[model samples]
Structures are given as structure tokens and as C-alpha cells.
Target: MKINIVNPDLNELGYVIAIANIKDKHDTSAPSDYHWKILKCRMIIFSNSSILACPDKNDVKQVHIIFNKAGDDYDKLISLFVKFSLIQNGGIRSATPEIYQKCFHYTMTARIAPVWNTLQDNYLINNRDFLVTRGPQEAVKYCIVVNDTFTVIEVNAVKINLMLTEEEFLPGEWIRVLPSLNKAIVEDSYKDFSQGSKFKSYKNLRRHWKNIHGYRLPENESAYYSIQFWRGEPLLYPKQCVLRNFPIVIPTSQPLEKLIISRFVTCLTSKMANVLGTKLIFKLEDIQPEDSKSLAPKDCLLETQAVSLCTPTQYSRSQK
Candidate 1:
């Protein structure tokens, strides 16, 4: 493996770019065997933060790393950093060009797990004079440090957020409405919820809806309606979210199931909102169940009578 460092003489912050190359020993004319192929990779790092950016160009025999700070281990991070550098140097294949092109356009927020405590302590003490103190609540901040060999990257935190209770859903009587109703709510608020939108697929929408709102599938089978909130604009990427008022309503009468779902949603939403530096709004309502097509009371009745359970509050950081 060989490494090259490239510094673009453009920005004042002085972004540092590193590229890695791995030679393939396998003969190209030989039969398609694993032993014949060589592995090559690339990666990029910004001076301002620890987040890794994908390459803007492409080459053959490339590998891409999916950023998941919470779930990725130290070994995985090291592997990704190497590949990221390779990608930055145009040594890897460009399977997803859009991702690489948009990599640097957005900011990523991630928490430092306790596993990297030693690294975090070292960075904090070394950069103590440059640290900025905010409110009583400590905000978590991390930076990526490369070694002299330029083969490894270490994640270190200068500050951390105060631990807060996870948001959860409470047990209550929720109205059961047709899936069409949920669709209508989303379409009304977000123009991108249409056919050409990224959320056109029900399965994709459901997955993201559950992930963003903190709803989880039940352990056992049971018949019940579920209420979920859809916050943010209907964008292809959650990190590109602009609007933050979309709400999803799932009506369920099952007390036990509703309680479980509510608690899970609440806890997850609170944690996600805080981590993403977004505000959360909770709207609760109780009304007589009606037919999906019938407008006995009016279409806007719920919106007018909705009660706010959680008001939006700014957090210290936002994660992708």
C-alpha cells in the first residue's frame, strides 16, 4: 500500500487530502478467481471535522464505505479511511457518482462512542486552549487525526453532549385511518411526495418514516392502528431535509401495542432530534372515528384542535 497527501491551495482552513493505493497481484488473463485480483482504495478528510468524504471521480477496482458512526467499529473506520483516500485520488471505481459529487455539499453529525474515550481524552487535552465553552450542557465534538504513516485515522472528541432520556410514545386511543389518509397528509405538505418523488415507494417511505420518527415493529403479531409523524421535507436524503412540519397519523385502539409503539417513537424522536440539532413537535388529538372518505366534521378539524406535546428546541449538533 502507498499513500499520497494533496493539499489544495484554496481554503483558509487548509483541507488535507490523502489517497491510498493497493496493488493487485492476480493476473488479469487468468480465470475469474479471487486470488488473481488486487484491491485498491481512496478516501478524503476535511480539516474542520472527522467526517470522511467520498471521491468526486472514479477508477477501476474501487470500494465505497457507508458512514455509520454509531454502528461502525474502529477497525471498520480504519478500512473506510483508507478506501476514502483511494477514492479521492481517483483510484477506485465510481459506482455511485452522485454520492461522490454531493459528498461535501452536506454536513454530517455523529456522536463519539465510549470505545474511543482514550483518543477523545488525548485530543481534548492537546487542543484544550482552542476549545470553546458554550452553555452548561456539554456538546460532543470530534476530529479525525491521521498518523505519521498516513495509514490510520483516529477519531477524537473535544466535547460531548449531556445525556438525555430517549423520547418515547405513550399509550393512548389513536384513530384508525386508511393508508390513503396518511398519504394525503404527506402530499398536502410536501410536493415531492408525488409519483416522481423519492418517497413514491410505500416500502421506502415506511422504512424512512419509521427510522426518522422512531417507530419499530412489534415483537408479536397483532391487529392495531399505528400513528407516526413525518417530519422534514420529502427529499431523497434525510440530511437534505428543509421543511420540518410534516406529521403522520396512525390510529390504533390496541392499548398495549399503542403504548409500546408510542414509547419507542417518543424516545427515538427525542434522541434523533437532539443529535440532528432539530426541533421536535408533538401533536395529539382525540376525535370520533369516521369513514376515510366522509367529511362529517371537516378535513381541517384535527389540525385546528391538535395539541402540542413537544415544542421544537435547538440542540448542540445535527447528525446525518
Candidate 2:
């Protein structure tokens, strides 16, 4: 990666331009897939009384904060706190690109899972151009991270929601997780213990349970288990993501696969940024995979800088 300083007149602007090549060292292919990526330097635009600060940028073209080098951007932020570290740390040395790529990959995978699962599970798939992939990897990253918990629950609705509605069952009815009765008394025993009565219909029962009780589990069994209501949607293995089957070649062979991968990476990156105590602002750019030929052009690429302040100023907020 080479660092380019464009607009020297703005050199005092406190931003540095760092460029690096991302390569697939794991692949023994002759050229070893590679791509040139860029990062904009940053200055502390805002800081709180204590430890963390929200960094901002003057350039809005980039999507993610580029560490230029690689290796746990999450961890990299930590070293920034060392005695004297303000964006320009040791002049941007070279390191592993694996972490950046993985971070992006995981993030994208996590985000797309919910939507994909929704389509597959509910059999409600559509391509009305209603996709939620119109932002930088970093921004998309946060969207997925913040929204992942909700998406997961949506994907696995059955295990989450209560099968019966207050109206479907008598007002004072109750059903337990166990097929057989527990020593626990149902103060509201008016309800039938039969699974059939627990839900008015399998589909509605599953949806209701998901919406109402997605986060809390029934208080009966101690052992871990996955309760399947119906096989309507194929189950996604834990830790398995939509990008698992995506192609390594640029300009991915599969459209859906590429989309899933890109979304996951962008989302996960934002998640990591939040943990690092930074507010990530992202801009989305479109570059076809076939057109990507630097090193290993990532499924999703991010050009990130930091934001020091998130508070909406009178001028900015009023414009809205």
C-alpha cells in the first residue's frame, strides 16, 4: 500500500491519505488475488471528558475508516491511546489484511442472514429492488450490528414467540413447554395442554411467539435445545452465514452470494467500530467485482475516517 497526499494546500487539514494493497496470501494462484485499497487520515474532531472520542472527517467519499494496514481494527484503536497516537501512528506500517477482510466478511454475513432467512423461512422472497444495501461497509456494518439481534429472532421466529394469542385461547389459559405436565401449576389451567390448542394455527402460532417472546425462553427445561415449529424455512446452522458458499473469484459468479457477502462485511465492521467507541459515518460506492483488480478486492470495501462528535448542531439539525 502507498500513501498519497493529495491537495497539499489542505495538508494542514490534519488528514492523511494511506493506500495499501489487499492480497490473498492464502491463495497460491499465480498472481495471488490482490487489490489496492485506500484510507483517509483523521483528526480528533470531538472528545468526551473521559476515555473515548468520536472522530469525524471532511471527506465524505469514503465508506469505512481504513486502518490502511490490517489486524483487528478493534484492537488497533486500543493502541491509539498510547502516549502519543493521533491517527498518524508510526507512519502506517504494513500488516495482515486478514482481519480487515474477516471483519468485513463476518459483518456482512450477519446482516444478510436475517433478510435471507426471512425470505426462505416465510417463503416470502422478493426482489422488488427493496434490498437494504445502499451504504458504506462501515455504515452497513453498524446497521447490521445494531439490527442483528432483531434479525436473528426474525429468522428463528418459532423458538421465540408464544404459539397462542390471548383471544385464541380462553382469557385465562396457559400452555407449558413440556409435552407432559410439570409439577408447576398453571394458575390459568383453563387452557388446553394439547399442542394443538396452544396455537390457533402453526404459522400464526410461530409468528406470535416470535414477536412476543423472542428474547425470553420458557422457564421449564434447563438443557439447550432448538424447538422447531414447522419445516417451512430451512434452518441456518449456528455461526453459519449466507456468504459461506460465495465464490472467491472477483465479480462473484453468483449475484445473491455476492450481495450477502458484501452486506455481512459492512455490517460487522460497524459493529466493531461501536465496540471501539467510535461513531462510524459511511458513504456507499459501487464497483463491480469484474472491474476490481488491485489485490484481493474484498466482497465489500470500506474507506473509513472517524467522527469526534455526533451531536446535531443547530445549523445541521435545522436543515433537516
Candidate 3:
């Protein structure tokens, strides 16, 4: 959404004064829920002036403002920086000396990947031990690694705040074996094959199943369900697993990929819709920091003049 303010009144120094409303979209019926959570607000000023007068004079042209949204109010009138002097043939520039910090603030709704099921349970066990012992040790570091092009990056272990509902996995889907499954049977039967080995790879194992167990392996390995058993724990045979109320966690850290960020934004927008009990309709705008010295300043008079139109009437009368 774009808002334009035209022909704003200038102050005594002949600078435009404007107020911008910093708000998120919401439904009138459910005032409690907000569609878009404004993590940060960036004010970009485009003018002919080379040097602008801003709230902070140290850096003149643009400013990044942070807002507090804990309150119930939605309408926030923020005074932005616009005062400045025009430098002939000057272009737009960022007044701040430091680079704008790239940060994000939004909520998301994502399915707990089947792999995360065991991880979450393990985390709870470790967390509970730490709490009981009151140890100074850091919590176990768990991350999700994704292959980006050729590079592999790990995502930090996320904590789930709310579980909206339980979603059942349909039959004939690939699922990871729970750690609590029988380890002895798995190790004794499939000692030759490594963890996560395909059922078709070991032809002898397949023959044993066909002869002893009286079951034949699926002709197409790709179509058959696959499972990732716990480390050092092999599955005796393929078994179907289903998920229930898989926890959804908040993404607290920035991801390496832009596509991941976009997904999070979409998920969060949908979650907000569900919370508000309203139709899901929203947009996300990435708040990227601007570079300094990008644009030149425009032409404007200096405020150094001693005589002004609004000088005190008493002083003027006494001097006369």
C-alpha cells in the first residue's frame, strides 16, 4: 500500500512538515488481531535539496524508525524528517553514517517437518534436564540444513509457541521412525545395511523378506515410502508413521535465503487471518535500509537570516 502527501505546509524555516500514519491492516469486527505486524518503518525522502534537516542532524536525508505496538491503539501519527536546504544539482542521499540494520519482525505458521518430530521431543528432554540440574551449560544446538545451490546452511533449532491443531498424515506417506521403536530387532535384522538404506539395495534382505516374511518389495523404489531412522538405529522393515498436532514454531532468526523469508511471511499472514477469524488477505513489504549519499540535495534557502515574517510584535514595535 502506498500513501502520498502532497502540498504540506512549511514551517517558519520554509521546510515541509508532514505526519505519517504507521499502522498495520486489521479487521473491524475483530480488533484484537492485526494482519500485518509492522516490524520496522523506513522513511525515504525524495527532494531536490542536497542537505536535509532531519530529527537527528548528524545524518540529514533519511531515517529508520522503530515503533512500539504493545498498546491497543492502531493509529500512530509519526512525524518524519523533511526539513532541509537544497543543494543545486544534488541527488537523493542517506544522511545516516551507518548501514541500516536488516531485521524482520513477523509471525508465521509452518508445519513441523516430519524430521522435526523427533528433534522437538529430544529438545524437551534436554530442556527438562537443564532445568532440573540448574546447569550453566548452553542448550543443545539443533539446526535445519538446506542445500542452496551447492552451499549447505543450517537453521537454528526453533521453539514452537502455539499448536493450532492436529493434522493427520494420509496413508502411504514417507515418515521418520520414532526413536522409541525396537532397536534390537532393527540392528539384528539389518546389521549389514546402514541407517536410511533403501530396501531394494540389499537384494539378499529383499529375498529373505519374500521367502520368510512372505512379502515382496515394491518394484518402484521411488514410489515406496522411505524413512529416516534414528542414528545407529535401523528399521527392521518399512513401517508407516503418522503425525498428530505437530508443533509449529516461530522463526526468530534471519534465514540465508530470500525465498525462505517469503515463505515465512506467507505463513505468518495466514496464521494472523486464522487468529482474527477473518478472510486471509494481506501483503508483506521488506524493510531494507537505504545507502547514504545516494541522491543529491535540491535548492532551498538557509535559516541563518535574522529577520523573519513571524518575529515578535512587541520587539518590532519597540524598535520602531
Candidate 4:
């Protein structure tokens, strides 16, 4: 969705102001999936003189904003510098000159508008722990249950994949695990086989299966049925709910290749989406940080020191 604000009253605000036309497509279809609809908006204000636009990013608050936007080019440049310094130094602690300079560099080279206000910060903090579904299947990876000992038990094959490996094998992530069930099983066994092996007896294997291995069919519980809206009607279907109560997963019949690419891209903007607390979209304009204030730190000296000295040096040391 795109919103165009044409010829906003510059006399009153002296700048063109326009609202992005936001459409809640989900509401039109799946009304319950999302509570609000958001869209990307762009405000282009061209004054007789060069309009200075400065953006500030605060780390403590994790918010970005544009401070002042009406000045000469030189002043605008300075304002941009200051805006960057503010964002890089908005935190409670002071930053190093080097850190402030780095922030300035980022601002000077910025291609997109910074988010305004502390809303971005809140969104980041809150959605940091969100369950994002990105595979072609969009199926729930597993069900999580905590034992009395506080140990978590994941209850699905996909969950096993995620926990056992760093490579993200989301529910729908496609891999050629033999198409035929029997063929797949034989391939899996061969893939796991090593050059030398012991315990070849069927009884020994059965003992291993009984004592060290677990075998069971997927659960067919009705509660596992996920409800989705089609047009104006509700449809009950199978879905994967993460171990956590939040972030329900629904599988798609699409091919695996397409799903994987789309999901990876979605992860990149997750930071922006969570920061803005708006639905995720490719449009960076929709992500507003909630006003102009540097959330990083005010003082550059301390910020640099913290990064160079205060923070853990394990990575640097390891490199050495």
C-alpha cells in the first residue's frame, strides 16, 4: 500500500505533509489475524531554500527521529551531523568521539528516513522475542512443554532439527529427504552410517530403540487444528504452534524454494518491523521511530570506551 500526500499546506507548516494510504488487507480478509493495518508513507517537502533534514537515533530507547528540517545546505549538513551524534549518543552513558563519529558517518550515508519517537524502541524490545514463521510449510516446528525440573521438551521432528543445528531448518525449509517414505528411511540410515560399526543384531537395535530411542506417530489431536479465515469464512486446518504460546504456524502448499527466499528477506526487516510495531512490509517508510531523539548516548567518549574496554573482548581475543 502506498499513500501520497500532494501539496500539503506549506504555509502553515511550511513543508509538504502527506499521509501514506494505509490499507488493512488482513482486515478485509482475515479480520482476526491482525488488529491494525499499516502502510508506508513518504513526506516530500521542498522549500524555496534547501530544507535540512536531521535524524537522531537513541540506543537506550532504540528510537530514531528527525530533529529540524529547515535551513541552508551547510546548516542542514551540520544539523544532519548533530542529528547523528544525538542518535549515536542518546544513551544514558557517554560515548567516545570515535563512536560519535561513526554515528555521524552512518547518518551522512543514510538512504532511508530514520524512524521517529520511542515507539521503535518499544517495538524492538517487545518483538525481540517474537516467533517468526518463514518456511514454505509455515507449519509449527514443535510443541514445547516444561518439566517439573524446568527442562523444556520439544515435541516434533522440526523442533528437533532447530534445536540440534544452527542452520535454520524452519518447518517449510525444503530439503531432498528422499521422496518415498521407505527410500527416505533407508537413505537416512545410510547417511548416518560410519565406516566401522558394532552391535549388528536386531535384538541389539531393538534394545537401542527401546532404551535410547523414541518412536511415535505424530499426534492427531483436534486442538492442533488451526483456524484461518478464507474470504469471510473460517477454515480449520492443521498448524504448528511453537513451544511458546505465541506465534502460531500455518503450512503452505507452495514449493520450498520460493518459501525459503521470502522467509530470509522477512528476517532482515524484522528489526524494522518490531521497531515500528507495525506489520512487516518491504516499504521502509512505514517504520517510524517516534520523534527525533538519539537513544544511543549523548557523550561519545564513554560509548566508545564501553565498546572498546567495558564490553567483553572474547571475540577480539579469540581472533588474536
Candidate 5:
């Protein structure tokens, strides 16, 4: 358990708002597993209000703003705020090389869990001026501080969010600490919670997650993705998705049969990716009749089988 030797050079980068661990999803089995695994240098991004975050380049490439000050990237910054305001902590499965180029996320350390707060706060937590200051552990020694421009509303929101985090849930829903029994299991594993946590298996955890907390664990992979991308309703595509009512997006547009075998890897695997070079996704609004096939209807696309529209592909296997 060795923390990053090289600290992030804050000379040109923005203040450190968050930090990521440098380990695989399956790395954690002990409390101290996180500290040493964190690489600080990778997080030192050159941005306006960038927060220190993400140890792996594959997890997060650049930084987003943290304050409410009027800047060119106000919306962008607030969006980050919104993102953390409602993020998932536990996950369904594991995927290698998580980033944008990949798809989905199945990490144990997904958000401000009690274990997360303990590990991170062990590094440090103090408000030099206002609400709260959580920079690198060096922030305190260097007499550093958190953002100063937080409004009363923002400060209250932060307090509320923190409270919710303490309770072990994300914002806009519920947040709090789990029972000691549950926490015992949750903080242990970084991946593969389905292995059975003191917290419980997927069935038990999912049940407690919903019944006790009043929130719902995504049963549908697309809904899981929905929870991943935006903490809103899942935007499931009929064919691409695997849920009876939701979508299950893969890393790549893989075959229907493959989804079950790979357990989500080998293509659109269960992963979190930071980079997807030059590919962008835009949420279409009022789609018109003139849209392309790519812009499939958002509504449950239903129609009677018109004909055998099947056509053989150029692939040798398809011809057979």
C-alpha cells in the first residue's frame, strides 16, 4: 500500500477538488489499499478550475471546473457539480480498461462512500475559509483551502450532500452510511460485490439498496448506463438493450449472443473509460421524420414483422 510518490504540480493546474486511486476494480480487499495506489501526478491537469481527480488517464482525461464564478465554462463546471451530486457508488460487473473508448462502469469506489470519506479524509479535510477544503493532504500543510466562491445555497447543498454521503447514498434521492454490517462488506471489495458482501450478494444488496434506502438499483444494463451517464431515466434502445424495459449498451455494437458470454467484456464490456477519441454523442430532442436510422425512436419502437429484411453480411460466418 504505497501512495503516489510524485505529488501533482499545482503550479499551473487548478485547485485539487478530488483524487482517484491507481488500481484496478478488483484491487481493494483492505482499508489501506487505496492510499498508496493513488498516483497524484496524473491528476495535475492544466485547466481553469480543474479538480485533482482520476489516477488513470483511461478513467478521466481532463478536469472540470468546481466553482460558481462567472467563467467561460460555467455550464461545464456546474455540470460536474451536478454529476457528483448524483452518482452511483456500487456497480454490476467488471470491465477491463474503463473509459469512453470502453463503456459502463463497475467500480466499488464509485462515489463518496463512508470508506471513501474515511480514506480521503484521512489524507485531509479542513476549511481554511468557508464551507470545506479538501485538497491533496499537502493542502493543509501548505495552508491551502477549498473553493471560496461557494454561495449560501451551494454551501447548504454541499452540507446536505455530505450528509447524504455520510448516509451512503447519492443526492436527489437518498444518502447515508450503511449499517456497520453492510459497511463491513462494501468497503472491502473494489469490484465483484456479487461475490457476496457482508453487505450481501447482488440480490440482497439490490434488495437492501431499494427496500431500505428507497432507491432502486438498475436491473437493466441500459438503466445502469443511464445511472452512469445521467442520473435520470434510462434511454434504452430496443435491440441494443437487454432489459425487458431498458437498454444495455455495450462497449462496441457486439452480437446479441456475445453479451451473455463475455459478461460484457471483449467488446462493450463493463468498464469506465475516460477517452473515446473523436467520438461524440448528442442527445436528440424533438426528433423529426427526417432523422437517420441512427436516431431510432426514443419511444418503445414496436411494429409487426414486415418481412425477412435479413441480408447476409460480407463476413464468412454470416454467408454460412
Candidate 6:
């Protein structure tokens, strides 16, 4: 039950920027569950510079990006000539990215793996897609300018229009807002007997569960009866917003081990706090993208239910 971002001014520091309508933590009303009923209104902005894109001031929307961070790094090996495209989303409980093309300021990226020498199924499922390789353009590091105002984010089916990060490309990721300990899931040493195999429950998950630091996420509904809010449709915004950072480009190099043993880094809010080196603090004061319904807290709004993911009786809280 944590969510912080106090005294931020220096562009906004590192970055994660939020604006959720959050609520799809599962329960797809059951037809087979893949209909995704309501969790739209999103406005994410993870950073490492490449700043907000898609708002062609006069024309300059070029694509091809790939300097990846956050989530899966898997111990290095996908620098295939290095690109730098740009991008968004709703929720996903499971595969739904069929996207072939739709247009409106486009940018495509590709580099999935798992080909263990292709002995067919001998090395167990390994035939990932998207591998359109290319090289040279001088390997552009990062750059973006044109910020007068821009942010529309419709999320669900898709609705773009970004251009709000004035300038950034520093050494990002050592943000501090503190207050966060209380994560008990434990159990890690990585094992997997692989019998009926649902990954044998994947060794109980523990690539990073942080567990402590300052504090701030309460905002009504009694803080969800005292910790434990998670289902997955992207929650955690609780209140007091006001950020504007966009510095990024962390790569001193060190993280590697990750062949997929349930690293589960982010279901939107298990960002597992206690950070400093990895860089990705979250916030966005003045609430852009039309202020995102005031970021809720009309006293939790229950009877009428106008703000969820936490006040509608809790539904997400796993930043660790």
C-alpha cells in the first residue's frame, strides 16, 4: 500500500508518470475472459529519454527505436544494430497483441528470442517472432523537442498525441520519495521440477520485492483495510500528483540473469520500491492528459464509484 512522489522539480526526475482509470484486475465477466471491460483512460510515460513522441509539430515522426530498459533484460544480447523506435496500452491478462499496423504516427520494434538451436521442441517451446533487422543511421542516441502541449491517450483500442516532456536525456534513475516496507511473499532459490508444469508454480516469484522506504499511499477507503491491493488492470495513483520529469539513459551495465523464471517485474504496480540505481520512480503532478478525472479521492467515492483500483474497494497495490 505505497505510492510516493514528494518535492519533485528538476524536470521530474527519472520517471514513470501515471494517469489510470485502472480496473480490470481480471474478472472479465467470463465468456472466456479476454474482453477487457474497463481500465482504459491510461497515460503512461516511462523514461530514459526518447521523450514523448507522436505529436508532429511540422513533421519529423521517424521510427525504429530499441534501447530497451525496465522488465526483461535477460543478461544482454539484443543490440542487433540498435534502433530507437517510440510507443502504449490498456491491460492484458494474456496475449492480445495481434497488431499488424494501424497508423497515425507509427513506430515498430522487434527482437523477441528463444531459438535454442531449433531442435524443434527438443529444447521446449522456442520460436519467438519479430526479427526485422537493420543498422546504421549513426546509431542516434536520443533527442526530442517540440513541447507546447500534447497528451490525449485513449488507451484501449488506441489514441495517441504526446509531446509534453520539454527536455531530457541525463543519467536518470536515482529518484527518492521513500516510505514503503511490507512485502512478504518470500521463497526464492529458483527450482522447477516441471511435472504437470504450470512452471511448477515458478519457484514462488522473487526477482525483486524491495520491502521498505518512506511512505504516502493512503487516500480514503481506509487504505484497503491495511495493505494488499492487487489483481491487475493497472492501479496505484492514490493522490497528490505533480511531476514533470523525463531524464533517461541508464546503462552503466550490470543486470543480466533472466531466462524467464517469473521475473514478473511489472503488472503495472509491483515496481517493487526500494529503488535508487535501477531508476524509475513514478509521478506526474499537474496531471496531464486532461487531468485524468482529478486523480480521484472524492472521499473514495463509493456509493457512486467514480475512482477505482483502490477506492472502489481496492484492486491493486504491489509495488513490491
Best by lDDT: 1
Tens-place lDDT digits, model 2, residues 1-320: 11111111111112122222223221111111110111111111112111112112222221123332123543444344332122333343222232223233233232233332222111111111212222111111111111211111011001111122222222122222221111111222222223323233334333332232121123222111122222221111111111111111112224543454454445434433332223433433343546333322223332232221111112210111
**Candidates 3 and 6: which is better by lDDT?**
3
Candidate 6 lDDT for residue 319: 30
Shift of residue 18 alpha carbon in model 4, Å: 5.0
Ranking by lDDT: 1, 3, 2, 5, 4, 6
| lDDT, each prediction | 0.25, 0.23, 0.23, 0.21, 0.21, 0.18
TM-score of each: 0.20, 0.19, 0.18, 0.16, 0.20, 0.16
Q: Which lDDT tens digits does candidate 1 get at residues 1-320? A: 01112211111111223334434332222111211111121112222133334321232233333232333332454665554333232322321323322332222211121111111111111112111212121111122222222211121111222111122222242221111112112222222334334344444444442322212222222221223334433223221111122222222234533443343334324333321111333333222244222221122223334321122222111101
lDDT of 3 by residue, 144-194 (tens): 111211111112223332222233333443332222221122222222344
What is the Cα-based lDDT of residue 51 in candidate 2?
18
Ranking 1 against 2 by TM-score, winner = 1
In angstroms, give how far residue 189 of model 3 lies from its true place. 4.7
Runs in model 4 deviating more than 4 A are: 1-18, 22-67, 72-320
Worst 10 residues of 1 by lDDT: 1-10
Tell me the tens digit of each residue's lDDT in model 4 across 1-320.
01111211122112111122123232222122111111010011111122212112211112222222323433443354343222232322322223333322222212111111001111110121111223212211211122222112121111101111223223322221100100000111111212122334323322322221111112332122112121232222112211211111222233542343233234434422321112322321121334112222122112122211012112110111
lDDT (C-alpha) at residue 264 in model 1: 31
TM-score of 6: 0.16
Model 3 scores a TM of 0.18
